[model samples]
Target: MKDMLWLMRNIWRSTIRSKILPVYLMLPLLGVFLSALTYSSAEDETVLRIGVANLDKTQLAEDAVQYLDGLSHIQVQMVDLSALDGEVASGRLEGGVIFEQGFSEGVHSGKPGGLQMVSVDGEQATRHIKGLLAGYVNDLDAIARIAKGDETVFAELYNQARSKSVSLSGEMVDDISADQQKSRQSIGYLITLMLFFAMSLAGNILREKENRTYFRVLTAPITSRSYYVSNMVVHLFVMAVQVIVTLLVMRFAFRIDGGLPLWQMFVLLVIFALVAISISMVIVASARSTALATAVQSLLIVPTSLMAGCLLPIETMPAWIQKTASFLPQRWLLDTLHSLQQNGISKDVYLNISILLAFTVTFSLLAVYMFERNEDTRVFV
Candidate 1:
């Protein structure tokens, strides 16, 4: 036990001394900041600038403008009839709503040419406003029909409709979409970094073997099993630190919520870190040389991470690719993170966790078998 602790301490020191450690820790935070910036800009895109050209100069026309202006996302500006088209076409406005002369009379008489919607971007920019304007026009048409061409009744009904009161209750929903997306992307980058770090640590076994350090260590009070166990312990410690530091920066520094408790995310990531370590062990045990191990690591980690949606969203992938990703441990880790984020604690989380553990055990066993079966691997034993 003392020897294992000593070995772990030495390995930890060596790892922390590397310049690459800082990069690994910083990349996730950088990703989170960039994601936050991108989403902040995207939020601005929701506000639409609309020009209102009211040639009718009636109560209905002004009321429509006020209604649109009162909306949360639409910004209605009163513009001249002549400038509406130019404003919309020149990209100064998203779209325009024009009320031609006699719009009220047309509404009362059930005529069609009183309203026009224009946009350079066509339906994309004007669709929502079109719907809103249609709704407004429909209400006016209903009131006009009820009055039946009586000026006094139409005016009275129009005033009543303008002052109509209905009970409405609203609750602010905290939109975690930007934060959630940032969290997912940051964690995805972290996962890839973890895998690469695991591979780097695992490669030490081959390096030490090549340099006779493994043999030298075994000649001391430590056995082969003890040395390997110490290495695994060190790997776990470094990975745990990676998870902790990255999440801390995300939560406090960036104020981004991943929609799950910090402890829950930590536990899930730690489990994945174990899987990463086991995978690295398999890569190291299967390869005869450090160069071969590196080649295999690059070939396996990036491609598998890509398939697992650690580099891209799983939803964007085709159905067949998503199915194929289900076979990967990283996919299970990410899916578990997503499940917990969306559904909180659920059966799917447990199922995915079990699968991750199963992956760890499977890879650990495979690595052991490979190490034992290899004739040129006396250093491992």
Candidate 2:
């Protein structure tokens, strides 16, 4: 135990003295910041700008403008009739709604011209706005028929219907927030960074072998087993620091909403970190040289991370790619994180946790077996 501690201390000193700790830590922080920025930019895209040209100059046209303004996802601007086409053509407006003259009288007489939607861009925004206008016109048509050509009766009933309020009450079945998407993306990038760091640490074994430090270390009181354990301990310490710093920056500095409790999130990340370490061990055990280990790490980490939804969303990938991702540990960790965010530590959380542990143990056992069978890498017993 004492030897392991001493070995750990030395490894920590070496890592610090190398002066690359900040660089390694900076990568994950940068990833979190970039992901946050990307999500913020995307949030702005959800709102559509619409222009209204009221040529009718009647209460009906004014009411239509009010309805458009009331939509939560739309920003309505009352523009001159001539500006509507230019605005839509220049992309200043997603689309335009034009109310022709006598729109109100025509509606009352059941002879209204069809509503016109102007758009240069063939986007669904125009279609959605048209649908909203169609629904309002339909309601007005129903009210006209109810009045039976009586202007006074139509005006009375129209005003009453417009002023009428329907009470609506319902609990939110799913607490969906934009912040949840931001958290998922931030954590995804962080997981990729963690894997890269783990691989770098695992390659330290190859570095020691290259520099002949492995033989010298074995000559001391430390057994090969203690040396490997010490390395694993150091890897965990570094990963813990990375996880804590990233989470703190996300929660406090950036004000990201992590739908799960901080402790639960920390626990989940730590468990995933173990999987990363085990996979790194497997890489080191399989490669015969430092270069081969580095090459193998690059080949495996990028593709696996891509598959695991660390680099891109799993849903965007092909069906077969997503299916293959189910077999990867990173995917399971992300799944658990997503579950915690959506369901808040439900029963399925345990299942995901168990799967991550199973992956870690499997990788660890395989790495151990590989190390044991290969006498050439006797430095790791």
User: Which lDDT tens digits does candidate 2 get at residues 1-381?
Assistant: 888888899888776665567777778888888888987887785778888888898888888889889988999988998888898888888888888888898889866564678888664658888888788888888889888889899999999998999999988675447778778888889988898898877767777777767667867886655766788788898889989999999999988887877888889999999999989988887777777888887898889989889878788999999999999988888899888887787889999999999988888888877765543545343
C-alpha lDDT score of every prediction, in listed order: 0.82, 0.83
How many clashing pairs does model 1 include? 0
The C-alpha stretches of model 1 lying farther than 4 A from their native spots are 1-10, 44-46, 86-91, 101-114, 120-123, 138-163, 169-178, 209-227, 288-292, 339-347, 375-381
For each candidate, what TM-score against the reference? Answer: 0.80, 0.83
Residues 45-131, model 1: lDDT tens digits: 577899998899987778878889998888888899888899988888999988899887888775535878899877787788888
Runs of candidate 2 exceeding 4 Å displacement: 44-49, 56-59, 73-79, 87-94, 101-113, 141-160, 167-176, 215-224, 377-381
Q: Which whole-number lDDT from 0 to 100 does residue 182 have in model 2?
A: 79
Ten contiguous residues with the weakest lDDT in model 1: 372-381
